[model samples]
Target: AQTVTQSQPEMSVQEAETVTLSCTYDTSENNYYLFWYKQPPSRQMILVIRQEAYKQQNATENRFSVNFQKAAKSFSLKISDSQLGDTAMYFCASARGNKLVFGAGTILRVKS
Candidate 1:
């Protein structure tokens, strides 16, 4: 079984600053996929970034990036130059089959 863990329950960042959300997982499989999904107040899950276990380099999307530690089973998300629109509940997830296992989620509040 694969399980994702987000240590920080809540995070706050000032607009134009940077924030990093920590996440860790436990998995025995060698191949899998990790993802960070952001859900705003509207409750829409949006893909923030994704990283493949086989890939050595981290993934980046606009202001979002990931630090994937395969051996440690850790995958963290970094949001640079955070904006007000970035305020949302960030969830870390792992997917292998049709279903995805998600963490409890970290509430990110961006102050303008």
Candidate 2:
């Protein structure tokens, strides 16, 4: 069984700054994909970034990047130059064999 853990329940970042959200998971599968999905007040799951377990290079998209430590089974999200639009509930998810397991979620509030 795979499980994702997000220790932070809530986080706040100042506009134009940076913020990092932590996530860790336990799994036995060797080939899998990790993802960070953002759900705003509208409640839609938006794909932020994804990393394959076999890929050593971290995944990045614009100001969003991930610190994926395969050995430690840790995957964290870093948002640079934060903006108010970035405020949302971020969820860490693990996918394999058509099944996706998600963490509780972390609420990110960007303040000006």
lDDT agreement with native, every candidate: 0.94, 0.96
- Give me candidate 1's TM-score against the actual structure: 0.96
Which regions of candidate 2 are displaced past 4 Å? none
RMSD of each: 0.8, 0.6
Q: Lowest summed-lDDT stretch of 10 residues in model 2? A: 93-102
In candidate 1, what residue range of length 10 has the lowest lDDT sum? 93-102
Clashing pairs in 2: none
Taking the candidates one at a time, how many backbone clashes does each contain?
0, 0
Quote the positional error of residue 98 for candidate 1 in Å: 2.7
Off by over 4 Å in 1: none
Tell me the lDDT of model 1 at 34: 93
The lDDT, on a scale of 0 to 1, for candidate 2 is: 0.96
